[model samples]
Target: MPSLRHELLAYAVPRVRRSRELDDAERERGRLERWHSGLDRSLPTRLVRHLHQRYEVEVDRTGDFPTHVLTPRTHDVEATVVWMHGGGFVAPIDAFHVRYADRLAQQLRARVVLPDYPLAPEHTWADSHDALVEITARWTASGPTLLGGDSAGGGIAVAVAQSLRDRGHEQATGMLLLAPWVDLTTSTPSTAWFNARDPWLHLGKLKAYAEWWAGSPEDLARPEVSPALADLAGLPPALMFCGTRDLLLPGCRLLAGRAAEAGWPLRYVEEPGLIHVYPLLPAIPEAARAWRTTEGFLGRSFG
Candidate 1:
């Protein structure tokens, strides 16, 4: 049985069904702009701001994207963690992203870099993937590194890692994917079947958003857009989390199978009845456990 806290958190989050109107593009873009404007005032940001008072977080924007570097205040850093923020491929980073990235840096005794990647509608993968490749190439040079993200960001994290491997660059030591949207094409049956069941996602909205982000149907097959279609061999070990109720669970499961077949080291955990990206919620016990487990995994990789 899922934890009562998980159930409560799931219920507390309002459902995000697909809008029936054809003007969703304009409306979604407007909403995204609003979300970006209010992120500094969000509760998660406030709490993390309070907790991270002692840490050193340097904000850098000299590169292709805005990056936040969170350094552990206490302990010698063990590794670097580069986490991408998920906004369904079109949305910008929010308070939750800052909180999670900060927490990961503190807990893992690592330097955490949160990159604000290019979003869809305004930019395509061509614009973002190259920037990411450049950023990861520089970050991974320091030593052991972990790549991670939630939802669409998780998809980006894996794609970036694969891109590095393909280029003969040193890949990340490991990866942490939370409810990754690995397949944008809706190729997996669960993406469609679980649409009504998922509290925060719908297949109709997802497909539309993906199409907008990808810019065309053919681009969905590109490894940077959908890492599920990319070669999974010879990348670093990975830890993946998914919920049975998430519409993207089938794609995650498919990736898990591919990883196993390719002899890639992947630890995948699927929590029954939980929502997508549950680890980002922070209030639930499952979320806490997931972070702890991730820290342990990172420890093993760094050691």
Candidate 2:
């Protein structure tokens, strides 16, 4: 059973952010406008203030997008974490993502780099994949590095890891995936059932977002777009979390099964009746427990 707060949030978040009744093109245009206007990528003022006061916040603008590096004021960094923020490949990084990354940096004594990746409708996965792979590779070269993300970002993390392996680049020491949207095809047999039960995700909306991110119908099955369909061998050890109520659970299970078959060391945790990305939720018992599990995993992996 989930905590009361979890249950309440599960019901409320969907209502607050659910897709409006509009055609796919209209939604795409609206999102592109938001991206072009720069409103979509803006960090919350409160979060920015908090980061400056508590941590060393540095921004690197050399890449296609700005990467924000957050380092704890008092802790010596044990590792580097290149964390991707999730927005279904369409929305921009939310405050919750920065907060979650900050929490991880503090708990793990790591430097967290949050990349502001290009969003969809205006940009496809190809626009950012190689750049992200290079960024991740550079970080992994320095020290023990972990790649992590939630939702669509998790899918990107897995794809980047696979690219690193194929290219013989320095691989991340570990991966942390939270409710990853690994299969853009969204063809998992249980996905439709879970979509109906999921309060925050709609299969129809996700399919549209997938098409936008993939850039074509055929590309939807590409490993870069649908990592669950990719070969899972020779990747770094990974910790994955999913909630039974999430539409992405079937894909998570698919990836976990494939990981096992490929001898990939993956720790998968499934929480019943909780919402998507439960580990990233703030002030919830479930999130706290999930963070503890993550901390333990990082400790062992970094050792």
Best by lDDT: 2
- Over all chains combined, what TM-score does candidate 1 have? 0.90
Candidate 2 regions exceeding 4 Å error are 19-23, 31-42, 45-49
**Candidate 1, overall lDDT?**
0.80
Clashes of 1: 0
Per-residue C-alpha lDDT of model 1 across residues 113-180, encoded as one tens digit per residue? 87877667667787778788878888898878888999999999989989898898888888889999
Span of ten consecutive residues with least summed lDDT in model 1: 14-23
Query: Can you write out model 2's per-residue Cα lDDT over 73-179, one digit (the tens) per residue?
Result: 87688888899889888777788888787777776688988888887878899999999999999999999998999999999999999999999999999999999
Model 1, residue 49: what's the lDDT? 60
Best by TM-score: 2
Error of 1 at 113 (Å): 0.7
lDDT of 1 at 202: 71
- In model 2, residue pairs whose N, Cα or C atoms come closer than 3 Å (at least 3 residues apart or on different chains), thus clashing, are none
